[model samples]
Target: MIDEVVMLRHGRTQYNLQHRLQGQIDVPLDIVGQWQADQSGYALASRFYWAKVNRLATHPESIAQPPAAAAERTDINQYCEAPAAARRMVVISSDLFRAQQTAHAFADLLGLEVTCDARLRERSFGQWEGLTREQIKAIDAEAYASWKRHTGGETRYGVESRAQVGERGAKAVRELIQDPRYADDETSTTMMLVGHGSWITATIANLLELDPDGMNALGGMRNACWCRLKVRHTINGQPADRPLFELEEYNKAPAIADSADWENGPADLRGSSMPDWCPIIW
Candidate 1:
C-alpha cells in the first residue's frame, strides 16, 4: 500500500502574531508556539496507537502469534494481519527555522530523522515580506490590489506567482512519493512535510486537482494544523503516473474553553465588551 502523507504547517511565529508576511525569512517559534508543537506531537502519537488497535481488532487471529511470526506467515488466513508499528515513518521540512523546529517535534516523538529541503520553503513574498496587509495597502495600493485580484502582474514587485509556487511545491512532494525506497515497502509508512501555510495549502490543492479559484477559496492553514492525504494505487497494476491524492482529514486542534468571563465577573458590559484574552493557536 502507498504510504500516507501528512502535511503540517509550522507553529506560530512573531510575524504570525503581528499579521505580517513572513515569506522565506527565518523566525523561531514563540513560547505558546512551542506548546502547540508539543500538543501536535501528542496528537500524532495517539493516532499511531489508535491505528494499531484498530488493525488488531479487525484481525483477531493475527494477535495469537508474535509480531515476527506473523510477518513470516504466508497463509491466506493471515492476510489480514495487523500492520506492524510504523517504524519507518519519515519527516521532512523546509529549511526555514520555524518549519525545521516544528518538524523536529514530530521527529523527536517518533524517533525519526528529519530531512530539510529548500524546495519546501514558503513562497517568496519578494517585496511584500515583513509588511502587514494594511501597510501594503497604504504603501503600494496598486500592487496590493493586483495581488488580491490574483493577477499575474505582481512579478515586478518580487512576489512569486501563485501558479508557480503550487507547481514547484507539488513537484517536490511528488518526487518524495515516487522514491523507490518509500514505494517498495509493503508495510505502511508515513511521511510528514512541514512548511508555510500558503505554500502547503496550495500544494495540496494542486495534488487534489482543485481549480484555481477553488484553491483560493480553501483559505489559509492554521498553525500546527495538518491534512491527511491517502495515495491510491493505479488500477492497471502498473505504477501510477499520477497517484490519486484524496483528502482524508483536515485542520483539527485541541479544544480550548473561554475563561475570560469566569475571571471578569458577570457585569453585563454589552456594547463595551473587549475581545477575550485566550491565546489563539491558529
Candidate 2:
C-alpha cells in the first residue's frame, strides 16, 4: 500500500496566465511553469536524499531513531534501495499534456517512468473549457452563479461535477492499492500524482471526507505547487482499507530563491505577511 502520497498540480500554461479555464484542454506549460517544474523536481529529489533512507535497510544505525519516521514505512526502491520491507517510489500522472510535462520533470529526476491515467485528468469543463472566467460569467451569468454557489451547473453544460472527479480519482487510487505492481505488504510506497488543480483538490477532499466545494473549504493548488498526505496515517495498527489520508502540506512550492524570483509581480514586493505560521523546517 502507499504510505505517503505527494499530489502536485501541473505547472502553469498560457491559459493559466490569461485566467482561462483549461479543463482537459491539453495545454502545455509556459516558461515560468517549466522553471517551476525543474526547481520543484530538484527540491523533491533532495528531500529523499536528506531523509537518508537510502541507507536504511543496510545501515539503519546511520539514521537516528527509526528510519520509518522519515518514510512513513514506505519503500522508495530506486531512491532508497531498501529491502522488500523498505520504501519505494512511483510516479503517476494525468493523461493530459500539462500534467505529463510536469510529471516528466520529477520522473527524470528520479530516473523513473510516469504512468498516465485518464481518471486523474482535470474535470471536463465542457463548453466552458477554453473560455476565460470573465467570459464564462458574461456568456452565462446564471450558470456561473450556480457554480459559485456550489450547486449543479453540470445539468446545463457537459461539465463533470466535483463529486464525479472525486469519485473517479479515489477509485483510481484504490485500484492502484489492489494492483500487484505497486501494492504489497512488504513494501510501503511513496506515490507522486501529477494532475490538475481541481482534480487534486477534489480527490484529496473526498479521501479526507471533507467538503472541497464549500466557499471556505479546500482551495485549488497554485500552478506547480503541491500537497502531501500521509496515506491512512495510522498508529498502533495496520493501515485502513479505504484511501484515507491526512493533510500534511497544501499549496506548497519549492521555496528555493533564485535571481528571477520576486520579480515583476507587485504582490511579491508588497511586504507579505507570514500569518503566524510555523514550519517544521526553518
Candidate 3:
C-alpha cells in the first residue's frame, strides 16, 4: 500500500496583511485565521465520515444492524472503527509557531499527536528577514533583481539562495520519511506537513524533479492552501520511492470581505471580516 501526504500552509499572520516577507519569523494566527483552522478541522471530519463509510463497506459482518437501521444511527461512533491493519496516519509540522498551530488544528480532527520538526522551518531570509519586496528594491535594486534572475549567488544581503532553500527543505522531508515510525509501518498512512510558502514550494518542486525556472513560474503560495502526494513502497525491504507527488489542491480558504464595499457600518457586517490581528495576504 502507498502512503498519502497532505501539505498545508499556515494561516494568516500580521506580516501577511502588511505585505511583508515573513521568512522564518514566528507569528501567531489571528482570530479569523483561527476560525479558518477550525473550519479546516471540520472539513477533515467530513472526510473521516466518508473514509468510515468505505471501511464499513469492506466488512459486512461487522454491521450487526441492517444497512437501513445502521444508517439511522445518530452517533458517529457507529462508524468510527479503527482502520484495517493495512492503514495508519500521522501529522507533523515545522517548529515555527504558525505551522505548529495549523498542524494542531488538523491533529485534533484526526485524533493524532503532532510532532514539531525543526528541520521543516522556513528558509532563513538572513538580512532580508522582515522586509517587503518594495523595501528590498529600495535598499539594493540591482542585487535583488540579479538574485531573482540567477539560480545561485552570494548571500551578501542576508537572503537565502533558492538552491539552498530547496536542498534543506528536501533533506528535512527525506529525514522525516526515514524515521522508524513512518518507515516501519506496514499499513498506508496519511501524513500532514504544515510549513511556510517558499520552503514548501521548493520541496514540492524538488520532489517532482522540476527545474528552478519551472518552480519560479509557479509563484507564491496562498495561506492555508495545500498540496497532496502519494508515496509507494516496495512489498519487500527495498527503499520507498515516490512515483509522484502531484498538486492535488491549491488556494481554497474563504475570501475576506472588503470593508470599503460594505454599505452598512461595521456593526451590521454579515460577510467575512478580515482578522484584526493578522495581515491579510489576499
Candidate 4:
C-alpha cells in the first residue's frame, strides 16, 4: 500500500524569476532551478540513511553532525545497509514542463519512471496567464484590487476558482490511492507528486477539509521543496473506507540546498521569486 505522499513544488522558471503569473504557460526551469532539482534528488535519497539519525526536516545540522559514539556509528551504518526491497519509491508529476523536469530529477535518482498527470497542473489564471502584478493592475484595476484584498477575485475574470483547482487536484490524488497498482502493493510506497504552488496548496487544503481560499494556513512552499504526509488506511486499528493523510513535514527545503536559503526564510535572489505576498498566483 502507499504509505506516504510527498508533495513537491516545481523548480523555478523564467516566469517565476520575473514575478509573472505562469498559469498554464509551461515555462522551463532556469539555471538555478536545475541545481535545486539535482540537489533535491541526492537529499531525498540520502533520507533513507539519515532518517534513522535525524528528523525529516533536512535542516542545516542534518548532515553536519557526527555520530556521538562508536555504537551510534555502527547503528547508522547498519541502517544504511538495509535491503532496498523493504520499500518502493515512485514519482508522479504534473504534465507541465517545469513540474516534469523536477520529477525526472528525483525519479532518475531512485531508478523509477515519472507518471505525468495533467490534473496536477497549476490553477488556470485565464487572462492573467503571462502578466505580472504590475501589468494586471494596469489592465484590470478592479480585479487586481479584489485579488490583493483576497476576496475571491479568481472567481471572476474567467480564471479558475480555488474550488475548481482543489476539486481536480484532490480527485487526482484520491484516484491514485484507490488504483490497485499502488493501493494493493505488497511493500510500502513513497509517492511524490511534483506540481505547481497554488494547485498543491489548494489540493492539500481540500483533502484536509480546510479552507482552500486566499492565503494558505500551511504557508507557501519553496521551489523544489516538499512536504511529507503519511497515508493511513486505518484509524484506531479500524479499516477506513478511504485513505487518510497526516501532515508530517511542511515546506522543508533540501538540506543540501540549505546554504542557498536566506535568513528571511525564502530563497536567494536567484531562487524562487515568490515574494512574501505574491504567493498564490505565481
Let me know the TM-score candidate 3 reaches against the reference structure. Answer: 0.72
lDDT of 4: 0.74
Q: Give lDDT tens digits, candidate 1, residues 1-282.
A: 446888888877778767788999889986556656666767775665544343444445545454674656445344344344333466789999999888887667645568898999998999889988888888877877777777754567798877678888889888888777555465566768888888887788778766544434566687887888987767577867677788887775544313323212234532253332233231
Question: How many residue pairs clash (N, CA or C atoms closer than 3 angstroms) in each of the candidate models, in the order given?
Answer: 0, 9, 5, 0
Predicted structure with the largest TM-score when compared to the true one: 4
Task: Give TM-scores for every candidate, taking all chains together and pairing residue i with residue i.
Answer: 0.75, 0.77, 0.72, 0.79
Error of 2 at 200 (Å): 0.5
lDDT of each: 0.70, 0.73, 0.65, 0.74
- For candidate 4, give the lDDT of residue 257: 59
Q: Clashes in model 4: which pairs?
A: none
lDDT digits (tens) for residues 82-102 of candidate 2: 343256677889999989999
Give the residue spans of candidate 4 off by over 4 A.
48-83, 214-216, 261-282
Show the colliding residue pairs in model 2: 74-87, 74-188, 75-86, 75-87, 75-88, 75-188, 76-87, 76-88, 77-88
Candidate 3, residues 155-196, lDDT tens digits: the string is 786777766787787777767776777555555566778888
